[model samples]
Target: MTSIVSVRDLKKSYAGGFEALSGVNLEIEKGEILALLGPNGAGKTTLISTICGISIPTSGTVRVGGHDVVTDFRAARNLIGLVPQEINLEPFETVMNTVRFSRGLFGKPRNDALIDQILKDLSLHDKRDSKIMMLSGGMKRRVLIAKALSHEPSILFLDEPTAGVDVELRKDMWDVVAKLKASGVTIILTTHYIEEAEAIADRVGIISKGSILLVEKKEDLMQRMGKKRLRIELSTPISELPQELADRGLEIAADGNALIHDYDTRSDRTGITALLKDLQNAGLKMTDLETQQSSLEDIFVDLVRETS
Candidate 1:
């Protein structure tokens, strides 16, 4: 697939000698949803801003749909729509007017039919005539999305789109995203919600301290860094693991009711058979066994901590 957005050796530094983005390199393919995950002030927004032409990069290059963000700003920016983290809509403007004006600002010809479709798709059609101030927070957020889609940009940047929204609203927004993807829109979102990314993103990127820690296909990343634990529920509570099994990295639960063993799934030998045999030899009986896999949140926290 051809890349719609590309970054190479991207660097950004402030006058105070603080780096917001450090040697960042990334590529977003056409028609893919890529989620950028990071802690507060981890450079996710900075990178997005540079790509969208809202902020200039101190160094490096960003291209959107074959147009250079710096040299061909107009062409690059025209192909993208950005829904910022803050809701900065005109308080007095009606939803319909706001969306229509956004399209006009992009020099698009008047198209009421297209505007109506955008509002309806975002579930804002009912609120089209309502003033921005009269709409609830969730409705306002939907208007923001409607406005971003007004000009029919190929790439959409959603910065914390579901932040502060209720559960129902969040689910609604996810559905909106799914419909947009089905229509062939490329989405790049920055979110603190790990599960949201885990549920929606085709690929996930972890950023920390102004650098991208890792970017991989969601399932592949999980399979590679994710670990599984075998929990053996002993029939007889053991105070301590026997010396014979001390070589194995076994953790005794604080309650002393179960034994937890961590093993690499990628390994050829899990040693489960040997461990069970050794447990029986040590006079330990397991009543039941269960395995738990690490989630995306687990891998994210560990990666950030490792970089820190």
Candidate 2:
């Protein structure tokens, strides 16, 4: 798990003395997808821009493949590819030309074979010769990805890659990310869609107010911070929780059709047995039972609340 990109004490400031990033330290491992989740104005884009050498860091260091981004700009930049949130492609330019042009920008020799392969990998081969304006939004996004990979960068940064994409298309983008990772491209993507992070990221990093809240394995984060609920369906509707049930930390659902008992998955004793026994003694009839686990969104919201 070698770090391909490392940020140490990174900070960015404006003339008005507004800090976008504050002493941020992060390590993006080689060949893994790291999803950066944050609200608007959380400095996610600024961090990506600085790492790609599009913006200068006010202080501290960012190393891409051990090359300083500020001092060794070309070398560091050549090893990185960035697909920004906007679809700013030249509408008149053909997709093939657009992607090929990106490769040439890196001083790479003409390698149409490689470019074609990248296009094919992104499922954009059929539209390669079409003008940017002719492609759909999802196809345009795929073209952006192709352009990023055209340079054969070791690290790829996707800033809100699926911003306005449909659900199916977003899933397609996830598949593309998987292929990129399998090919040893280290990906660090910023996403507003929390489920996108949950689906594809090996690790999830939460950033807020210019500082990183936490970075952990997606599963570990969910397990450690996530909660579970026992959804006990009642045979009859109730407007409120009975005194006995309220003491057991059970609450009636909004529709009053069931009761919800929230518990930690990591707990050894969930008190379910006692609760069920208590329910029987209280003359409550259970019609069905179901359980639900907290999603990544739940953990993200809770963390933001605590930090804010």
Candidate 3:
């Protein structure tokens, strides 16, 4: 599997001496979906802008499909498409003209059939004759996607594609992304929706304070950094935990109906058997017991906090 995009020691600094990115390195494989996760001001957007040649880097190198982003910008940019966070389409332009014009910008020959396929694939065929100003917010967002795909680039960058949209629209967008993946298009997306990444991304990258914290396979990251919580419903209400059980790091619920214990899944011993035995010895009766694995959002928060 060869990388379609690569970055090395990428850095960006403003005139005010603020660094947006510092020595960032990443590789996006051909035809793979990679999700970039970070808090606001964490430099996720800055990194993507540099890779797509929208913003110049202060230092470092970025290559798209073997073409250097700086030295070979035209060739590199022609192979990639970007859907920015903001919707800035021409208000008076019809949907079909907008998409067709985008293709012409890339020097692609006029092909109504290809443009029609893109419009249909994005569910914007019915709105082809509608003006951009006449469409709703979700419809406008779909137009942006159709325009981006007009050039038929190998790589696509989606920046918060589903922000502020309704649940139904978001799900529809995900379905479109699935079809794009099936067509062998590599996608790199920046999102605040952790669940979306967990549901769609093949790999996850965490960035914080202008640096990439870690990148790993979704399953591997979850298995290695994810924790398991054992929740026990208490039969008897207790104001506080007993001294004998205080060493186990158990947390009593505010409602006084449950006890929560967290244990690392990768640990050699989860101590569940010992903990259960001790609870019985202490005369604590459990009505029910259940375990929950930590979500990607939990792991992301922990990692960012640790680095910050």
Best by TM-score: 1
Write candidate 3's Cα lDDT for 1-308 as tens digits. 89999999999998999999999999999999999999989998899899998889999999999999999999999989899889989999999999999999999999999999999988889999999999999999999999889999899999989989999999999998888999999999989898888878999999999999988898887775468999999998888998889899899988998999999878899999999998998899999999988788888899999997
Question: Tens digits of per-residue lDDT for model 1 on 1-308?
Answer: 99999999999998899999999999999999999999999999899999998888999999999999999998998999999899989999999999999998888998989989988888788888999999999999889898888899999999999999999889889988888898999999999999889888999999999999998998897675567899999987888889999998999988899999999887799999999999999888889999988888888999999999
Please provide, for model 2 over 37-78, each residue's C-alpha lDDT reduced to its tens digit, 9 standing for 90 to 100: 999999999999999988889999999999999889889999
Off by over 4 Å in 2: 230-275, 278-293
| Shift of residue 225 alpha carbon in model 3, Å | 6.9
Q: Estimate each model's TM-score.
A: 0.85, 0.83, 0.84
Candidate 1 residue-pair clash tally: 0
Order the numbered candidates by TM-score, best leading.
Answer: 1, 3, 2
lDDT of 1: 0.91
Clashes per candidate (backbone, < 3 Å): 0, 0, 0
lDDT of 2 at 212: 91
Relative to the true structure, candidate 2 has a C-alpha RMSD (angstroms) of: 4.9
Q: What C-alpha RMSD separates each model from the true structure?
A: 4.4, 4.9, 4.9
Q: After superposition, how far is residue 129 of candidate 1 from its true place, in Å?
A: 1.4
Cα lDDT computed for each candidate against the true fold: 0.91, 0.90, 0.92
